[model samples]
Target: LPATVTIDQPAVLTASAAGDDVTCYNAANGTITVSSPTGGSGEFEFRINGGTWQEGLVFSNLAPDTYTIDIRDKNNPLCIVTLPETVTIDQPAVLSASAAGDDVTCFNAANGKITVSSPTGGSGEYEFRINGGTWQEGLVFSNLAPDTYTIDIRDKNTPACIVTLPGTVTIDQPAVLSASAAGDDVTCYNAANGKITVSSPTGGSGEYEFRINGGT
Candidate 1:
């Protein structure tokens, strides 16, 4: 007498993946997570870009790029389930910002302005800010207080690509003017020998002028 036997094979391996892009400019925090895995031999292990296999279903700390994810059965190592769509991790564009500005002419003038050169190395219209204040579309910032400031620029296409310009904005003003005067008393009244001299005029751009009788 002969006995009949039957064999069973695991279903075809299949899976799907979802991913997230880097939150900040040039960041490496992108992630890819495997989900909806089906038709494998046993408990699943996952890997990306053919890296070492692990039981974890999520791959994190990945840079911005395209990736291939593979899911395999722990029971049958040869059965590898590839997600239908490859994972694509992306990041905000790298933004390079630089700026130069005009210093306030006088103390407390508050009329200083910043001129941000058309930003390079990023996409879309640029927005500007001062010291991380509210964002705006204008490149020139006017009526700024007399102090050191930083320009915050962002890409309209990618808000996450914000950058503080490398060059610091210094809206400054010269200190108020101060001076002392000395006069020589003439031996004779209204003598032509009488002389008044202004000494060591400090502050106010180091330039000074004396007005006799308040005359310009």
Candidate 2:
């Protein structure tokens, strides 16, 4: 006898026939299509990932992962079988990271922060690192010393996807100061204050009494 097939709504493979006489296969890539001795007129219920049942159809758009198919005999409900099938849905997501300024300079200080973002919507988790250090989530940094650093980012998946970027920070030195003085009774002096003021009528470039102060 021709084995009959029946499926519930949502179109999942609920149950099918067992014995060697009954056979089924996914006719298309990323889909599950089942056929039996029973004709098309036989209604079948189908569902995806154990979800609500719906009319059985040839194709469906399911999430990227493994799935199972169940089939049953519409004419003889007593004859039922569950078939296991794996459906691979392709969902390629892209990740990227960048800084507001490609390069920066700090005068005896480290002040540079990078901003990171992902264009893809389904990015589960994100991580970043500096100069191959520990991976950090959110791709952020603070109080970094003056040096060249590399930033790497990755997504949280079976096979993690990673991306790297290069950046630099330079430190500068402070300014210097000089002073001089002259006369028979003239006295050279250095001030503890930040500013140095001189009161002299002879403004010539000669070896005169001199003093220095106000800087480290």
Off by over 4 Å in 2: 1-88, 101-106, 117-122, 157-159, 166-216
User: How high is the lDDT of residue 125 in model 1?
Assistant: 74
RMSD of each: 5.4, 14.0
lDDT of 1 by residue, 97-154 (tens): 6678788877778888988875765565778889978898878888887888888878
Q: Write the per-residue lDDT of candidate 2 for residues 1-216, one digit (tens) a residue.
A: 599788753333244322111111111224455455232225555545566554555545443455555554454443444566444444544455565422223334455455554423225666777777777765457656556666666655422456565453332222222344433432445534344455442422333354555444
Any idea what lDDT model 2 has? 0.47
lDDT score for residue 118 of model 1: 56
Output the number of the TM-score-best candidate: 1
Score each candidate by Cα lDDT.
0.80, 0.47
* True-vs-predicted CA distance for residue 192, candidate 1, Å: 19
> lDDT for model 1, on a 0 to 1 scale?
0.80
lDDT of 1 at 54: 89
